[model samples]
Target: MLMAKLMNLVSKMPINPLIGAAGVSAVPMAARVANKVGLESNPHNFLLMHAMGPNVAGVIGSAVAAGVMIKYLG
Candidate 1:
């Protein structure tokens, strides 16, 4: 959430900062939440697709992180 807000402030993009929250361990749920929040803010702001990118990235990132952790700690 903080990173999202910071990016929004720094980039000045029209993108909803809520999308950033989608980049979490709970991939699909986070994207859904972002979409829900965006819809609540504005009916026209459909952010599901936008949020998916981060959501997918989060999943991949988690996998990679887990691999690294296992490699070093397991």
Candidate 2:
């Protein structure tokens, strides 16, 4: 979350830092939580769509990491 906020400060995109929290293995849940938090801060700030990108990316990253671990350990 902090990294996201920091990047946001330097980046040109208007990305909600809360969406950073959505980059977790629990895909939908993380996105939903980000959306909920965003809504809490501003009712009009619906972050679900923004969060989903990172959420899905996280899942894919986790799968790739798991695959690498299995290849090395199995």
Candidate 3:
């Protein structure tokens, strides 16, 4: 429980945008590589990409996890 609280607090700490920007910058190159590997040419490929986007599971999982953490924290 202490570990979870510590991690939850740590996750909320503002990270340098350079770190995030660097991560965002790699997605396109990764997609291009996926294209070369024949992973991005299909319509379903976009679905997978969107799954990685803000609309799908990634951010949602964080939001839900944070919500749970906050609820219990308070």
Candidate 4:
């Protein structure tokens, strides 16, 4: 939810700033989300690893999107 909003807000910015913001923001956010899920889930469920997969993917996807956006916008 918040990530979506952040993306939307950053989309209006210039290419370089968008790429930098999204790239830097993703790392700590992914870590925070993974830790939160780990603490909330059952000990045996191993949800942290599962959650991190998508989180990292999202980060990568956003980075790719930023790159694509730069190709056209820059």
Candidate 5:
């Protein structure tokens, strides 16, 4: 019971930093996902990335920002 309560509290804590670490850890995994999705074609294959996020917002915002950069500079 005590363990459960501890876990519950941990779950409610801010996990964004952890999530970011998870995303960083997922770099290789993201490449795999991109390959699976065919984003890994030709030159893109070398630069494509796959990642988990520290949080949903972080990942989504990163993606949006990347898109914007690509739109303007890619």
Candidate 6:
């Protein structure tokens, strides 16, 4: 996803690993919050698994990016 690309760019900066972790954690939390909000108004319309697709993709994207960074940089 675009966020993964943005994170790759951001990684070029001299940020602490903890800060990077916090930033990454926000993705899943935001996705869950969005899903919860969406379900509240129209529970019959959207399934949890459907809402989770983007979240899972983002997680995978971040993981792949991190792997690439570690492999190349270290």
Q: Quick one: best TM-score, which candidate?
A: 2
Give the lDDT of residue 30 in candidate 5.
50
Please give the CA lDDT of all the candidate structures.
0.85, 0.88, 0.43, 0.54, 0.46, 0.56
For candidate 3, the TM-score is 0.31
User: Candidates ranked by lDDT, best first?
Assistant: 2, 1, 6, 4, 5, 3
Tens digits of per-residue lDDT for model 1 on 1-74?
Answer: 67666676878565567877888878689999999998999999899999999899999999999999999999
**Candidate 4 per-residue C-alpha lDDT over 2-74 given as tens digits, one digit per residue, 9 for 90 to 100:** 5556667768752221223323336657545555555566455344444545556677888899999999999
Clashing pairs in 6: none
Model 1, global lDDT: 0.85
- Kindly list the per-residue Cα lDDT of model 6 for residues 2-32, writing each as its tens digit: 5555666778763222222233335666555
lDDT digits (tens) for residues 1-74 of candidate 3:
35445555779763322122222324455334433444434544433243234223334566788899999997
Stretches of candidate 3 exceeding 4 Å from the true structure: 1-55
Number of backbone clashes in candidate 3: 0
The candidate scoring highest on lDDT is: 2
> 15-56, model 2: which lDDT tens digit per residue?
667777898989699999999988988999888999999899
Q: List the residue pairs that clash in candidate 2.
A: none
Worst 10 residues of 3 by lDDT: 16-25
Residue runs of model 6 more than 4 Å from their true location after superposition: 1-28, 40-43
TM-score of 1: 0.83
lDDT of 3 at 51: 22
Please tell me which model should have the higher lDDT, number 3 or number 4: 4
lDDT, candidate 5, 38-64, per-residue tens: 443444433232223333445666788
Which wins on lDDT, candidate 2 or candidate 3? 2
Error of 1 at 25 (Å): 2.3
- In order of appearance, the predictions have TM-scores of 0.83, 0.87, 0.31, 0.45, 0.29, 0.48
Alpha carbon lDDT of residue 18, candidate 3? 18
